[model samples]
Target: MTEDAWVPLALSSMIEVGTSAGAVVQGQEIVVWRDSSGVAHTWEDRCPHRGMKMSFGFVRGDHIACLYHGWEYDQAGQCRYIPAHPQLEVPKTICVKTWAVAEAAGMIWVALGAVPPPPAEAEVTALRSLYLDAPLAAVLAALPEGFGGTLAGQVPLVTLDTDLGTLRIGVQPIDARRTALHLTVAGPATPDTLLALATRSDAFRLSLETAGAAA
Candidate 1:
């Protein structure tokens, strides 16, 4: 993935304050966590120390600690504390590589490189993310015709006008063989409408996955 493109990692509501979750983009593991102040950060999933998955760690006020040895890293990805040596000052060299993160359109996005394009700015209601085992190209090819909806725009972002409402979709390339669709309503939608959209999305996922397996 190019550093210039911003990829949606998770739904904003999904990653609550003081929590962390694992995500992958093009096969690179990433840890997405929110601080007590509700600011989100993304970093390499590996702990700088013993190479433990940072997503398996716990979150303090503004720090995330690796579960391996209680190694705490501040929001800046700098190791600020070492429980093994409380009195010893932690080395500044111990820090997890971080990526530029942004929240827009009710989703959390991470830019792989330094010069990331602007995040997608749109007023939309969050639906849910759909993970599919099929290739992204196949999913995109099938989306317009499958939903009985009018599809517009291009990959990475698109719009589908359905009977319920217009749905804004952010395409995430999980890897070569997997893809994710971050779904949101383009405008105001009632809970019933959101539920219906979600159900329809689930059916599409099942159909795509089944066809991919057969292929």
Candidate 2:
């Protein structure tokens, strides 16, 4: 994906409130977190203080504290507190790089540069995010061979019609050699059906990886 493109990082259900997780988009590390009020934010995963990954930290109310030295950053990515130097006022320049974030179609998206028109709003049932040890192009090419769904939409966002329902999938390029697919159902589905779809996806992943290894 281009630097300006909005990349879907994770499934919306994956990052619970007051929780954070590490993600990679085209090789760039990012931290996805939600505050107490349930607003999601994305930022550079590295801490400016000691280069530690902010994903290793814990969330407190609306702030996320770096595990290294208890450096806390608010939802705006501004450093708000330092445990070691309680009386020291943090500089305005001390902050993490923030990204534009949005939630739609059961996925959390992050824009690396200028935000484009947001993904069209739709009601969807959250499924699961699938990661594969294969290139994005390869994964897309092999998708039809697996689920045999009628695929539609541009890259990074697509839909596949299956027996269960229409699957709204968000694609993510984790790197040159890895990709992620955030899936959600557009129509109602029972617990058993969802489990079956998930289980079938696991078989698809195994087959894809095995084929890549053989090739």
Best by TM-score: 2
Per-prediction TM-score: 0.96, 0.98
TM-score of 1: 0.96
Which sections of candidate 2 miss by over 4 Å? none
User: How many steric clashes between backbone atoms does each model show?
Assistant: 0, 0
Any residue pairs clashing in model 2, and if so which?
A: none
In model 1, where is the ten-residue run with the lowest total lDDT?
A: 113-122
Candidate 1 collision pairs: none
Which stretches of model 1 miss by more than 4 angstroms? none
Name the lDDT of candidate 2: 0.91
- Residue 3, candidate 1: how far off, in angstroms? 3.1
lDDT of 1 by residue, 31-117 (tens): 999999999999999998999999999999999999999999998999999998999898889999999999998889888877466
